[model samples]
Target chain A: MALLEIKNLHVCVGDKEILKGLTLTIEQGTVHAIMGPNGSGKSTLSNVIAGNPVYEVTEGEILFKGKNLLALKTDERANEGVFLGFQYPIEIPGVSYATFLKQALSCKRKYLGETPLDPVQFIKRLKIRAQALGVSDDMLKRSVNVGFSGGEKKRLETLQMAFLEPDFCILDEMDSGLDVDALRVVGQGVGIMREKCRSFMLITHYQRLLDYIEPDIVHIMINGKIVASGDKLLALRVEEKGYACYK
Target chain B: MAQKEIENIIDASYKYGFETDVETETAPKGLSEEVIRFISTEKKEPKWLLDFRLKAYNHWLSLKEPQWAKIKYPPIDYQSLYYYTVPKKKKNLKSLDEVDPEILKTYEKLGIPLQEQKALAGVVAVDAVFDSVSVATTYQKHLAEKGIIFCSMSEAVQNHPELIKKYLGSVVPYTDNFFACLNSAVFSDGSFVFIPKSVKCPMELSSYFRINARHSGQFERTLIIAEEGSYVSYLEGCTAPQRDENQLHAAVVEIVVLKNAEVKYSTVQNWYPGDKNGVGGIYNFVTKRGLCHDYAKLSWTQVETGSAITWKYPSCVLLGDHSVGEFYSVALTNNYQQADTGTKMLHLGKNTRSTIVSKGISAGYSNQTYRGLVKMSKNALNGRNFSRCDSLLIGNKCGAHTIPVLINENKTAQVEHEATTSRISEEQLFYCEQRGVNPEDAVSLIVNGFCKEVMQQLPMEFAIEAGKLIGISLEGSIG
Candidate 1:
């Protein structure tokens, strides 16, 4: 069975329908890239899968590991080993990154009936991950995402995902506004966390991000539906030519 | 004086209704020269102290309760409340263990475990006062070893009479205001702290005041003096049981930071607020002021999350060159609570500086205001100050206001003031809920984020407690 499967999903925000009849499935140990132009319901799909309350899944069934994924709350989904690297991370002042990350990690542990990491052990783990990601000590000490550069924020998100060691990862345009060097860092971080039991869905408009992190399959999404699917070369074709061909 | 006839005013129920009647020593219920004399005589106060109280009593009769604040309540019957009450049945306990069970239970109900455990280990001493008298004070001898005099105000007059005659009424004079005047006259008991020169207080000195029973007012006086090059941080918390008839609680606090010394005073006021209809609650009219003498500094940080009606303005006077002043506050009002509180910074010394940050949260039918002033004297060359006041309204029925006054007479002085009012946006809440957080948790996270700036100013131990308090108080604020 696939790690996450969606069958002919229909989603709406408020009274307006956004995602129409979208079907996709991803097995473990693979990276799937969803490339689409703006207003093509790419972000809507990402948000809906994350259980964003603003988006109503009018008609669809999302199954994760044989369980109904639609029944889970946002945090519940997070606790169930699902991680969404947000495109625009929320800036929560007064909540330090260290403090928030610790809570998120322990929240998952508590759900798994495991003992939470003590502060000393947690900080020791955090320092190694943060150092590897080039996240400065000052940045980790500050309020989460408050005054963080775009590149720093993306790297921080990836660092959190690495710490969480989720079974499935969703990158919602995580490469936007990132320079080539920062993209390499983020791509490498995601590459390190990809194991046999893990899967990923990279949602982006441009195919450039796919160049750094090669995907097993590339799907072209348009008008709330994936119109075409192919292999690695398909990403290059779309990068050279645009989504116009798929349209 | 006897309990006056109950007036048929707005009848409301108090929410924090609990009381303890112990074998306490109390003067007659009234405010008169004879009452002051009786208190002075009971405490064995010096002739000068007695004369001071008499003069303050005469001045208090000449003044009226200021009506400038936005709080509304019935008039206070000063004659019907006991001005002095002390536990005559005590054998002078050494710690909280030897204290009476009823008094200990009162503190415990208020969540103040006066134990020597790590949770409350940092607390240096406590002046646990009930109604109009102090019941117990801990760790006086340890503080005394360092030449630090920490005791009740009345006890200070009896022990350190010279210090009382000099500094008493110097920072907050007898005629400072109506409440201060009244407090000076019939002020029965309060904490008196004196830190000698170049000494850092070993631990935090705290005072917990509880108002039990109805129809009785609580008038306590607090005076803190940090001598030259000394430092101290003091905390004060107050609460009262619920009642249907409005009760009066008028207090006066004064701090003097001598040259090269610094004093930080923090208050977590959770006085009993009347029910939703705003019936019976404590009329919290208080006057707190501090003076930063030459080359000294003073800071007032408060988290006022309770009170049916709160009227206070803790101010600072920068009279010494290069002296500094700061005020950080987070005032949350729910139900029918009305709070009109802020601070004042007066700059007289050259190169003096001041900073003010006020965060007000209003829910239910409450009203919260931030009224402050920053004044720079003509002789204060190169004076600087920055003030920011922000208010967050939780519901449509609440109101938030900011009234700031900045006066600069010196040409080189710099003054900046900013204020903003924001309501809980539907978009923010939806964003959190989309993340699967419940409505209440989402609201609390956002509110905590909003007040992050002020919360950062608190000490490490207090910051955690303050954050939890904000979260708990904001529960049910969102619909």
Candidate 2:
């Protein structure tokens, strides 16, 4: 069974339709990349799947692990092992990164019927994961993503993904603001988390990110629909030919 | 988000709204010279104190209610309120166990168990004032052993008359403001603390005030004096039963800090905020100020989350050279409540400094405002002040406002003021929700972050309580 299945999804922000009849599916142990131009409904797809309240799911269905994902709220979808790496990470002024992650982890543990991690073990795990993502101790002490540079924000996102260890990860333009060195760190973080039971969907406008973390399948999205699908070559083709032909 | 869902999220009933049934005695309903005399005579106050009350009464009759605050309320009928009330007791209890079980239960329901064994464990000395009388005081003996005077205002008047007489209206004169004058005229029981020179207080001193008598106005006066080179931290908490008729609560708090002394005052006010339609609640108008002497420091931290209409400004008079003043506050108004609160920093001494941080959260149909003033005199050479007021709105119907007044009399003084009004961003909430935190907890996290600086200033126990109060106050405010 597919890890995530979207069937003829139609989404809108206000009265303006952003995702018109979009459909996609990701099976377990797969890395699927979606390449699209600006306003091509790529971000909208990720948001709808994440159950963002701002984007109304006007029609169709979203299924995760053979369950009706549309019937749940954002946090429920998250508890079901679905993750959306934000394009622009928010800066919460007073909530420390450690506190936010602890809360999120505790919620997931409660949902899984597992005992919550004690503070000592929690901090131990946090330090190891933060170190792997190249996130400094000072960064963890600061408020979540507050005053973080573009690279640091992306790294923090990677750290969160590593911490949550979601079954289905959605990387929405995760490579947008990262420098080459920082991009390598984020890519390595994602690579370390790949497992036979987990899957990922990488949404991007360029093929450079694919060179770091290879994709099993790549789809081209244009004007609110998937126009083409191929393997890694499709991303390379878009990088060379641009999105003009797809439009 | 469904309108019904938003209503459900915001319709959390007041948790501390249950009234305890007990026998009580109340003064005649109305304010007059007779009522002032009645209050003084009931407490058996000294002749000098009665004269002070009479003088304040005459002055109060001459002053009108100030209309400068950005709040709307029906005209207060001062003539209709019972000025004083007290629980009927056979005699004064020598210990906590002999106190009225009903009053003890009331405090327990409010999460403040007054049991000797269960008391905050010597870490805090509490003076619990129920209605208009001090019921039971804990850790008094321990505090007294350290040469610190911590007791109810009435007790201080009887036992420590000299100290009370010296500092009673010294920091905030009886003529300070309308509410202060009214409090002076008919004030009942409140906490009083005095730290001797060079003595750092052994533990945090606390006062928990409750208004229980129907139709009675709670007028409590608190005075704290820190002698030269001493230090003390004080905590105050208040709650009242839910009632349909608005009750009046006018309180006056004054603090005097002498040379090389430091005092920290914190208040968590969670009075009943009335029903969703705004039919009944407390009209809380208070005057709290502190005076700092040479090289002294004073800090005020308050978390206000209750009352139908709140109008108060905890201020500081930096009167001595190199003195410092700080005000950190987080005021939340939900349902149909309204709050107009902030602080005043008067920099009169050379090289004095002050810092103010105010955070206001408004939800439902409530309105919250931050009105503050920072003034530096011409002789305050190199005086400095920095103030930041931030407001967070939860719903479309709610409102938040920031009004700051800055007066720099000398070119050498530097003042920086910044104010911002914002709604909890959709992206921020979504980010948290997507991380498996529900919207309610998400809102709490973001709001706590918004009030991080102020919360840090609070003691550990009070910080935890304040954070929970912030969460409960904002319940159901988001979708």
Candidate 3:
């Protein structure tokens, strides 16, 4: 069975319907990218799948691990190994970045019925991982995403994905505001996680991020439905000819 | 002139003339001349103190309860409430079964033994009380070496009448306002601290350390004096939850910081709020103010989370050159609670500076208001004040208001005020929950973040656990 299965998913914000009858499936250890123009309900799919309260699922059956996924709360979905790397990650001042990631990881550990990590061991691991991702000790000590540059915010998001190790990774516009160097680092950071039997759902408009982390299949979503599905070549074709051809 | 007249008129024989005193545990329910006299007599207070009470009571008769705050409550029947109760309440403590179940429940929660709980609760008149003698003596002797006088108001009156007479009501006079006037007339319990010149108190004098410590109860009057070049930090209220039966609480706190002295007063008040429906809970009306001399600094840091209705303004009169005054507060209200709290900074000295940081959090059906005043007097050349007041609303039903009054009389003085009212955004909440934190923990995480500045002003342990206290205050507030 697939890790995540969305069938006839219809979502709405207020009285306006955003996602109209979207259906998709992702199996274990496979990477899939959803590419489309703006207003195509790309972000809505990620939010509804992550159980965001703002986006109401009018009709859908989202199954994770062969169980009803929509039945769980947002945190429950997180604890069950589903992670959403937001396009514009929220900035929460006065909460240390280190504390934020540690608490999130602890919650996942607790949900998995695992013992908490020792402070010394966790600090050592955090330092190593942070150094690899170019996150400074000062950044770790500072408030989470409060004053981070756009590149730094994406790096922190990648660092969080590294620690959380969700089974299904959804990166919504992960390459939106990245410099060339930051883009390479962030792309590689997500690329490294693709080896852990983790299914990836990369929602992007361009094929730039695909150069670093290749995807098995690419789905062109137009007006909330998968209009076309093909290999990585499809993303390159959309990037060159523009999304107008798909319409 | 009245003080001197009262002293001269208080005949020596009148002290012994008062009938040996009734054997009753409480005065009859009412406020009158007889009740004031009865309270003075029961406490064995000095004639001048009694006269002061009488003077305050006489003035109170002409004052009415202020209705300017943003809160609604039933009119209080002052005449129907008891003005005096024995410090050592005569509780029928034959067995634990006779105690209020709430008391026992709190005892169990605090892990206190039945006997110690009874003693702490002032239910019994135990002679061989909890052996705080050794502990108290240790700190008292240490403090005495530095010429520090730290004791209860009653003890201060007995041991150092001259000091009390000179400084009591000096900062906040008896006729300051309605509630302070009432507290002045019938205050039964409070703390008094006198830090001598050039001496620094070694410990954080907390009411929790005393074995015979009595809660300020409904009416508390406190006085603190920091002499020249001295330093001290005093902590009020207990960290643990307290079940107070009093529905109306009015307190007055006054502080005088002399030349080159600094004093930091921190209070963490957690009285037992009524049930979620707000059937019955304390109405905290407190007036706290400080006077700062040249180069003196006084800071009031308070974390108020209890009480159905809280009306308090801890202020400072910066009278000395280069003096500093700071107010850091975090007032959290939940479950039908209402709070109107802030601070006043009167910059009267040259080059004096004041900082005010207030964070108000409202959850459930609660409402909160941050009312502040920053006044720069005519002589306050180069005086500066910076105030940042922020309010966070948890649910849609709760409300938060910010009212700041800035009166600048001096052309050279500058006052800057900034305020922002924000509800916990769905994006912020969803971000936390998506990271695997539950709704309650998410709210607490966001709230603790919002109140970080004020919490940092608290003592180390209190600051560390402030997040948990805020969490507990907003329990059952979110889904």
Which wins on TM-score, candidate 1 or candidate 2?
A: 2
Q: Considering just chain B, what TM-score does every model have? A: 0.92, 0.98, 0.84
* Chain A TM-score for predicted structure 1: 0.97
After superposition, the stretches of candidate 3 with alpha carbons farther than 4 Å from their true spots are: B1-24, B87-138, B208-217, B238-246
Candidate 2 lDDT, tens digit per residue, B1-479?
63333434565467899999989988888988888888888989999999999999999999999999888888988998888889988776778777779999898888886775787776887889999989977887878888899989999999999998988999888998899999998999898999999999988889999999898899999999999999999999999998999999999999999999999999999988888888899999999999999999999999999999999999999999999999999998888999999999999999999999999988899988899999999888999999999998877888888889999998999999988888777788789989998787888888999999999999999999999888887787765
Candidate 1 residue-wise lDDT, B184-234, digit = tens = 887878889999999999888888888885567788989999999999989
DockQ in order: 0.19, 0.73, 0.50
Comparing 1 with 2 on lDDT, the higher-scoring candidate is 2
lDDT score of residue B213 within candidate 3:
20
lDDT string for model 2 (A91-210, tens) is: 899999999999898888887789986989999999999998888888998999888888889889999999889999999999996889978987898899989989999999899999
lDDT of 1 by residue, A1-247 (tens): 5999999999988888888999999998999999989999998898778776667898989998878999976667877877788888877656677866776676667667788679999999999988888887788888877898899889888888887788888999999999998898879888898899899999987877987898999999999999999998888888889889777
Ten-residue stretch with the least lDDT total in model 3 chain B: B10-19
CAPRI-wise, candidate 2 is medium
Cα error of candidate 1 at position B159, Å: 2.0
i-RMS, every candidate?
11.3, 1.5, 12.3
Q: Estimate every model's Cα lDDT from 0 to 1.
A: 0.81, 0.90, 0.78
